[model samples]
Target chain A: MSSIDIAYIESDANPKVKRWKRLALEPRAVKRERATLLEGLHLLSVVLEHPKAEIAALILSEEAVSEAHELVEKLAERTGARVYGLTKRLYDQISPVENGAGCMCEMAIPAAAAPEDWREADVLYLDGVQDAGNVGTLIRTAVAAGFATIAANVGTASIWSPKVLRAGMGAHLAAHFVENLSPETFREHYRGRIYAADARGGRDLFAAPDYADGPCAWVMGAEGPGVSEAAIAVCDARYYIPIESSVESLNVGAAAAVCLFDARRRRLLKHG
Target chain B: MSSIDIAYIESDANPKVKRWKRLALEPRAVKRERATLLEGLHLLSVVLEHPKAEIAALILSEEAVSEAHELVEKLAERTGARVYGLTKRLYDQISPVENGAGCMCEMAIPAAAAPEDWREADVLYLDGVQDAGNVGTLIRTAVAAGFATIAANVGTASIWSPKVLRAGMGAHLAAHFVENLSPETFREHYRGRIYAADARGGRDLFAAPDYADGPCAWVMGAEGPGVSEAAIAVCDARYYIPIESSVESLNVGAAAAVCLFDARRRRLLKHG
Candidate 1:
C-alpha cells in the first residue's frame, strides 16, 4: 500500500477531534451542526453513489490506511474529499461500534423539503416510533417498497442518530427524509388517504380494499400504546395485519414490512 | 401492600446468584443446565398463560416487590413457585438489562422434540441466522403466521439466549423450537418441499406458482453469505422478493416476515 501522506491527529483534545466526537455521539450536535458521521467503509461507499451527497471529509484509523488502502484511495480521488487519519484510540472513542470497519465519513444530513407534488406521492409516516433499530429498519423497508419520502414526527427517534444510521444499512442515501414533522401539518398538506397500522381492532389488511390505488400514507406507531389518538384522528381508516390469537402483536418493523410490501404487491398486480 | 414472607439474598457470592448470572450471561450454562431466565413482568405474565410452562422460581428486586406487589404475590400463589428477593445491586448484576423491569422468572427451556408427523407440517428453517435480534424476531413472525415448528441449524443463534428471548417477546412459549438441527437430518425426515428466500437470481415471489398450497419449509439465511450451499441443495426452488435495485437487501427478519405472511395470506384466501 502506497503511503497517502494524509494529515493525522493524535491528541484527544484536538479541536477537530472534539467536534467529530460530538457529531458522532450527540444528536443535538448533529442537528445544530447540520452534519453527521457515517461509520465504516460500506456506508461511505453507499453515500458516494448519491450525486448530491456533500461529503465533508474522510477519516480513517491508521490501520485502515494500510488495510483498506485501495478503496480509500479510490474514494478520495473520486470525491476529492479531504482525508484525515486518527490513532486507533481516538477512532474507537468516536465510533458507535467497537473495532468497527475502521473508517468513517462526515457528510451533511440529507434533508429534502417536502416537494410541491408530495401530496400525490406515497409516504411512510413514523409516529413516535422510539427504537433506533425499528426506525432504521422502517426507513430501509420504505425505500425498498418504493416509498421515496419518509416523514418522522417529533417523538420518533432521530433519523440521523448513529444507531439508526447503522441499522439503516445505507438506505438513508437512497431516500428523501423529512424530520420533526407534525401530524397536523401532514393532514393539511397531503391530499391522499392516511391509514394507521393498528395492533388490533382495524380492518383486516388482506380483506381491506386496495388503498394503494392512489396517493396514500401509512402511519406506523410505537409498539405498546400504538398510534397516538392524535395521529389516528388524522387517518382515514385503520388496518391491521392478521395473526394468530396466541401471539399478542407483531413487532413494529415486521408490521410495517407486511403492510408496505402487501401494498406494493397489489399495486404491481394492478398495474401489470 | 401486605408483607409477603419471602427469602431475601443480599450477598452476590451466593450459589443461586452465581447460577442465575451464568444463565443470564452464558449460553453454554443455559444449554447445559436446561434453564433460562425471562426478564420483566410482561414476559413473565405471557409465560404464565402457557399451561405447560414450569415456573421454577420468581426473583424480584426490592423495588419490584413494592411496585409490582399484586402480580408478584398472585404469581407466587398461582404456581406455588418459590419466590425470592434480591438486593437491587445483586439483582442488577444478574439481569441482562440495566434499569430493566425488575421482575424475573426462571423456567426450563422449552425443548419439544419434532413431532412424529413433522414431515407433513409447514416449518420455518433458520439457516445460520446469527443476529440475536433477527433470530428472535423471525421466531415471533413464524408463530404469528401459524407455522407451528421452527428448526434452526447448529450455526444459528441459540434460541434461548437472553437477547433472543427478549426479542422473541414470549413467542417462544407459543411455538415449538428444534435447535442444533442438521440440514442432512432435515432433508431426510421432512418430506415437504423446501423453498429458500434468495436475495437475487430467483423467480419473482409474487409470480411464482402457489407453493403455499401444500406443506413446505422456507429456508432464511444470514444477511451477507445467504443460504449455505448445503442448505440450498435441499431446497426445491428459490424465490426472490422483488425490491428496488438500489437497496442492497432486506434485513433477514424483514425478508422472513414478507415470505411467511404472503404464504399465510394466500392460504387464508384459498380456504375462505
Candidate 2:
C-alpha cells in the first residue's frame, strides 16, 4: 500500500469531527442516508466481507492510534482509507455514547435492494423496539438462526443507531432492513403463518411447526408493554418459550435468542 | 374467607418506608437476614410457589391497587400476609426505580441447598459477571434451559440486586447460588467437564457434547473482556455460539440463552 494519508482533527468544530459527532450521537445520521458508523476492528472486518460496503474514511482519537497500533496498520493495508486522528478532548466531544470505542469509520449508505423473498422466509417483525441494543442483538440472532430479513415498525430504533450497531456487533451488512410496517400492511404482504412472541400465549414454542418446514413469521414486541394486542390478536399463533418454574419471563433479547436458535436447530436436524 | 386485616399507609415518613429504603438502594439488604423486597403480583406468585418463602408485609401503591384491582385482590386472598396501601405520590417517593409497577413486598430470602446431583446435569458457572441485569438474565436462561445450580464469583453481581431481580423476572427463588469462586475452587467442587464460552479456540456450539449424558458446566465472563484468563485456562473445552456471517458476538445475556438451550436440546434428545 502507498504511504497512508494522515490528517489531524484538533477541534470539535472541524468538519470531520462534526460528522463523527452525528455518527456517534444522532440516529438520523444513519437513518437519513447521511452516513453510518462502524467501531472496532472486528466490525471493520465484517464490513470488508461485504463487497459493497462503502467505507468513506477512518477516524480515531490520537490516543487510539497508539492503543490500536495493529488495527491502524491493518486498516491502512486493507481499506485504503485516509486515517484522521482527533485530539483526545475532541474525540470525547464527538463520542455519542459515554464509552465510544477508540476506532470508528464513517461509511456511506450502500444502495441495496430489499430482499425479494422477504415475505417467504422465516422472518422477524420488530414493532416499536425502542432499545437500540435490543434491536441490534435481535438482528444478529435472527441471522444466526437463519431468518432472512428484519422488518421494523415506524417507532423502532433506526437500524443504523450506534448502540444498535455496537450491540448487533455487525449484522447490518448481512441482514436486510425493511422499515414502515403496520400490522395490517405487513399481514397483506406475507402468506405464511404469523406468531407474536407474547407472555400470554396459546401454545408452547415446541408445539409450533419446526422452522425448517417452510416460511414463517415471528413477531417480537417492545421491551415494556410488549407487542400490541392488535398484533397479537391477528396472529395465527402465540407461543411461549416455556420458562422454568421460577422465571416469570426471559429478557426480550434473551427470549429472541432462545426462539431463533431453536428454529435453527430444528432446520439443521431436518436438513442434516 | 374472612375479610383481610389490611393497613393503610398515607404518610411518606412511615417506618416501613425507612425499612424498604435500605433494601431499595443497598445490595446488602437482601444478603442480610433481616428483610428483602419483592415486587409485582407476578413476582409474588413466584415467591408463594415456594412454601419456604415467608411473606412479611405487602406494599401496594394506591394507583396500582385501583388499576390492577384483580391482581392485588388475588395476592391478598392467596396469602396470610398483610397488605398495605400507600397513596400514589407517596408510592412514587418509595419506588426504588423509575416508573415501577407499584407493588413491593417484604419477604424472606430462602436458604437453598445445592442439587444432590449437579454433576450429572447441564450447568452454568458465572465468573465475575458484574452487571446485575446480565447476571439475572443468565440465571433465568439457565433455568429456562432446565439447567440447575448456577453459582456466582465474588466479583459478580449479587444474586438479588433489584435490577437483576427485575431482569430475572423472579428466578432467584429457584436458582442455587455459590459465592466467590476461584478457578481452583470451582474445579474442586464441580465434577462436570468445564466448558469456557470463549470466542477464540472454542468448538462450534452447535456440535458440542450432548447435555444429557454427563456433567457439564458452561462458564461465562463479564461484558467486553470475555472470561478471565485464569478461568479460560481451566476450561476442559471451549465452544462458541455461531453468529451470522458478519456479527462478532451476541449480547452476553442473549448469548447465555443460546448456550444453555443448545446444550439442553442435545441433552433432551439423548435422554429421550
What C-alpha lDDT values do all the predictions have?
0.86, 0.72
- Among these predictions, the greatest lDDT belongs to 1
Interface quality of candidate 1 as DockQ:
0.83
lDDT of 2 by residue, B1-272 (tens): 22555588876588887677777678877677556777766676676576667778777776674434455555666666778877877767656555667777787666644545454556688888998877877888888777767776777887776667767777777767666667777777677788888765577777554543577788898877888888887778888876554555667787788877767666555563
Q: Cα lDDT of model 1 overall?
A: 0.86
What is the TM-score of each predicted model, taking all chains together? 0.97, 0.77
- Candidate 2's docking class is acceptable
lDDT of 1 at B266: 92
Q: How would you encode candidate 1's per-residue C-alpha lDDT over B1-272 as one tens digit per residue?
A: 54556789999788899999999888889889899898887788887687688888888888774545566677787787888889999899878788876888888886656656478778999999999999999999999998868999999998898889999999989877778888888989898889999986677888777889888899999988989998998899999998888799999888889999999999988897
Model 1 Cα lDDT, one tens digit per residue, A8-118: 899998998899999988888988888888887678778767767888888888767454555566667777887888999998888888877788878888665665647
Error of 1 at A210 (Å): 1.8
